[model samples]
Target chain A: MAKMTLEELRKLREEKQEALEKRSIEGKDCRIIIGMGTCGIAAGAKETLSTFLSVLDEEKIKHVAITQTGCMGLCYVEPTVEVILPDMPPVIYGKVDADVARKIVKEHILGKRLVTDHMFDRPAADIIKQDGGR
Target chain B: MHIAITDYVLEVVQNAFEANSTETRVVLQETAEAFAVTVTDNGKGMSEEVMKRVLDPFSTEEGKHPHRKVGLGLSFLNQATELAGGELTLRSEVGVGTTVRFTFDPASIDTPPLGDVVSTFMTLLAHPKAGSLVIERKTETDGYALDRKELIGVLGDLEMSGNLHLLKEYIASQEAALS
Candidate 1:
């Protein structure tokens, strides 16, 4: 390889910046909230959250916000997650492991469907039906 | 409820983030005789009254949880440390930050296992409220330090899930290189 020139180095830097700087939370309409409370972490929430992050990256999914918060008060079914889309009421899922976390990224976020089995309480279907999330 | 030493570290450092600290530092040091960690944060500290009974499981910050009346993280950790012939020291001031240091014999049966520190650190990074996290790890013969801000400047965004796997791998590799 030849010695890199200044112009070439600048171009490369900008390219890398543009690619890596794709993270923008503003105007994001989708959210993946994971429970990171003591209970949640003890139950392997870290692994689940990691799976979600990697899957989202692999899928190149945008307009989504992934965050972790303290206890959600559902310690019995820890590693809980809440998925909130623009037109749907928040859906809480419990006992989410790595597999379910991947399914969430694909089946729920990409396929636009619900992972019903892992859902905390049947998807709040009644609330969605009442107003279609308004 | 903590199965690993990392669990306790995670549970305690989270308070610093929740307090809206702009910066937090965690130091983990270990040797054959003992293991210790110190977490210092430039966040809102508690008053003397709160500090007096901070270990009381039944007491919690006011209005933190409507239905819950207990904060078990510190209380449980204090109990475990005490049983393991360890000590948990907490120093805080209203305007100043808080520094919490705990130490225990690494060989004690009551001491929890040292779980995946990398995973715990990554979990801390994943927190939305985690501002600038600095981690310094030191063993008897090895040492390393990581700064979230520096990594972000190099890797673009930590929240970008795409970069997390790579970051995790990098951190894991760095730790593996240590003694």
Candidate 2:
């Protein structure tokens, strides 16, 4: 992980300010997730999330913000993560280590291609209702 | 009630570990009318300001940046307790320690049926190297306490990996007896 001084942390926070605000907005379509359950943390979701945040910082992807959530109910395959794109299907990926997290950023977030193997497909009925209709 | 309490206990224990606690104690007491659960940790404690915001569901501590963005664990626990006609209390002093207590009215509509507490306890014990978690469960007539150090001695040299299934079964039976 890259160590950021107070100034750098503030700068990074400033640079991502818009993205963060956008995420907080009620109707925006963004990919957001984190599994911080005991099982997930023990499985290393912390490092995985940090990797994603760093990648987002490095890539400077706007309009998409990452956030943390609790357990997704699957303890066996932990460090579980989910990605939601606008008007599209939400994909949940499990066993996400740092390497997998980087892949998710590069391929899913940037290339706009869902990584099939790691993708967790939810039944349509269970899809979380986003702020907007999307 | 069961799921909420279970989730709250799990989250609180995790926080204890995150605060660099070496030893933690959890106690659950059940009566005909209510259930009381307490978790105490000898970790790097927090200040009054941090304690005030700890249950806000939004404040993030410095070391917790990587693990959380919207701090919801304690908040969620509080909500769960409230919905169950229970109360959640937290006490902490910097450089001293922290303790969280949950008191629940057992018959409330929001209370969940107590589920597999033993499994949660087992998982904590399985990771003894990270820290020691002691769980005590009490009812009017009897009580049970599990200490990881004791289990380690029982297993002796034989890897828990190999005997995990057997251990799990033993624990299940013990839980059934308690229930």
Candidate 3:
């Protein structure tokens, strides 16, 4: 692709802005947060993050917000991902490579089902049994 | 140490966000032998005392992290810069802002390559405070500049997935021209 000049960016904005307006005005119902800390970077979080963007776009999923955050102190499981969907407790999935990221979007976000195998932040995920998470 | 020079840059820009910057500019310039990155932020600058220990991994702004105490990003980058015989300069004023510029010698074996800078730029803009950031990237022959506010103005909000994806393509395309 040729370099996108400001004029092209403006044109893209005009084209995409309409599609965006058709989206829910109530705001995003789902959020995908990627850890971009140093540890996360060393662990290939870049690929993980790019995967989420491409997957979400390919799936034509809207009303979803994708963001980057500092480490959640899960360096041991770098490349951590946190997904927050309405009506479900926020879930943090660790050691998420591109494959796991795809699953998180397909199975967790779109499927409305948690990918239990890679789930961390269990206390929050297991809210029904939360005894103050002690 | 970090695998790429861009990795250190991501961390540095994040630190600027934490500093409460309203405007941050990241300039990446590459040459035959060396590549330099200068990140300047109009945020709450550092004190002399803090600046001295900023690279000490053990030191970080208090109350920044409730449970964590160590910040190894810069410390690790320092190691890489030292091994590569690169130049690192950090200047700040308490109420003004901070400017961190570092040049890595690609000729040195210890120096890491400039990897995935386009993604790094996108990631930096993914931060909530990204609207305050701008990236100016240049190689010896070609270059481009991206302003976060301009992107958000056109694409809507960066927080949304659609906008983020669009921004990435726009960035990647610009970087491609520099090659």
Candidate 4:
């Protein structure tokens, strides 16, 4: 099979940009970040990240930007992920495998409803504060 | 997640970075008949016992990942490599880090697509722990290599979404030029 072509990439970028514009016009922006720290990767964060990317692409839901970060000091929450919606606090979800990641994309990201069951109880700011602003 | 071979390569790179590697080198070589990828890292390598257990589909270190009961990356890659009539090799040392190399017959019926490597590289560039990354792609006709430092100098910080897009364009253009 051939590698992805430049044209395909251009189209992908265009689609994503259009999605972003559409969201911005509605006055909102969203970002999804997956933790890829050692524990995270060991727990399958790589696959989780891949799952989110593929899900977002398959759904053609472009308003959200997908990114990755190191361990959030939540080792027990290997494969931890954070979702930030427009004007809302960042919600961190733990034990996120492929299925959980898909749900986060479909429900939390596109549907605008938080998945309370899997979310970390404390908000991101509180966690940062406890860590002394690392 | 279902994806192409290149995405799996990116997963391996992520694993290397997670190990706190000071440097990671990825080499992808493609010929008319075969495709090969190798990732080497300079981080804390695994012990022999750990390395032996890493290949088992049922064995993953506890506390490493929250919910996963197994580590399937190597096992899955091994299956794919063998399905393509190729082999997977892993070498490691206690403090020297690890190297994972695999090859596949591109013409094999079971071989998967190469996927979007440009995006994979861009994603790696965005990782904060990615100290140094060198990706080289080669074919019988041409080849090109990208260094992280050079990329940062040419396109600015990859953490920014705008720069990530620019970096992807740059890589895609370069790969196109190679072909």
Note the DockQ of each predicted structure: 0.06, 0.01, 0.43, 0.04
Tell me the deviation in Å of residue A87 in model 1.
Answer: 18
Per-candidate clash tally? 0, 3, 0, 1
Which window of ten consecutive residues has the lowest lDDT sum in model 3 chain A?
A125-134
Per residue, candidate 2 scores C-alpha lDDT tens digits across B1-179 of 22646666777887888888888998989998889889999999999999988888778796677876788888877887798898999899998889999888899988766666766776666754436677888897867677656555454321333334334554565566664
- Compose the digit string of candidate 3's lDDT tens values, residues B50-95: 9889899898777888888987878888888988978888999988
* TM-score pick, better of 2 and 4: 4
Q: For model 2, what TM-score does chain A reach?
A: 0.73
Query: Which candidate has the top score in DockQ?
Result: 3
User: Relative to the unseen true structure, what is the C-alpha lDDT of residue B102 in candidate 2, on a scale of 0 to 100?
Assistant: 86
Classified by CAPRI criteria, candidate 3 counts as acceptable
Cα lDDT of model 1 by residue, B1-179, tens digit = 68888999998899888777879999999989889999999999989999988899999998876889899999999998998888999999887889999988888889888899889988887677888999899999988777888766655566766567556755676677776
State the lDDT of candidate 4 residue by residue for A1-134, as single tens digits. 23444455445556566433432323336767788889999999989977887887798876676667888888987889978776455688999999999898878887778888899844545546543231
Ranking by lDDT: 3, 1, 4, 2
| Candidate 2 fraction of reference contacts recovered | 0.00
- With candidate 3 superimposed using the best TM-score fit, by how many Å does residue A133's alpha carbon deviate from the native? 23
Better of 2 and 3 by TM-score: 3
Residue pairs whose backbone atoms clash in candidate 4:
A43-B65
lDDT of 1 by residue, A18-48 (tens): 3343334457778788899999999999998
Chain A alone, TM-score per model: 0.72, 0.73, 0.75, 0.71
* Candidate 4 lDDT over residue span B1-179, tens digit each: 63589877977888898788979999999998779999999988889998889878898767878998988887888888888788889999979999999998987988888888777877877788888888899988888787887677654556766558666777877777776
Clashing pairs in 2: B1-B111, B1-B112, B2-B112
Shift of residue A83 alpha carbon in model 1, Å:
19
Specify the poorest-scoring 10-residue window by lDDT in model 3 chain B. Answer: B153-162
